[model samples]
Target: MKKEIHPDNYRPVVFKDMSNEEIFISRSTVNAKETIEIDGVTYPLVKLEITSSSHPFYTGKQKLVDTAGRVDKFMSRYGNRNKNK
Candidate 1:
């Protein structure tokens, strides 16, 4: 691991907008524009979609979580499939 041999691995790292201490970096943007600062260093933010926040899972309170129309699609596909029968 020679310093001179290493070609100055200087690159930009991404940090999620308004995150506590989490950070990420990639080649492409996942979503709209956002800004984040880490250790006094500012960087562009990316996707921050939450699957489970202060919801049921973390608190061990398993609850039915319906998405947009998953159940509707399932019912429409399988439920109505045997209607003519």
Candidate 2:
């Protein structure tokens, strides 16, 4: 609850998630050079790598990688030393 400790230039900005191509509008003080039109209105466009719409924690969607192939490759290269011991 401190006075004059916050920014005064708060405005509506558009945050675009690059991963999922989702856009949302919120109030922020960030400076953006790009502008985007949404619903016949223009807002400062900000590009983001991850957002609530695309994040794994919020959307419960996880990308599964093929780790078994990597493990097998590593074991074939270095796991032979343990077999002789």
For each candidate, the alpha-carbon lDDT, in order, equals 0.58, 0.92
Q: lDDT per residue, candidate 1, 1-85, as tens digits?
A: 6658754544564744232334466545344466667789766676454333323565576656679988888898888766788
Candidate 1, clashing residue pairs?
none
**Cα lDDT of model 2 by residue, 8-34, tens digit:** 999999999998899999999999999
Q: Give the per-residue Cα lDDT of candidate 2 at 70.
A: 86
TM-score of each: 0.31, 0.71
Candidate 1, after superposition: displacement of residue 42 in Å? 0.8
Which stretches of model 1 miss by more than 4 angstroms? 1-22, 27-32, 50-64, 67-85
Give, for candidate 1, the lowest lDDT window spanning 10 residues: 47-56
RMSD of each: 7.5, 3.7
| Among all candidates shown, the one with the greatest TM-score | 2
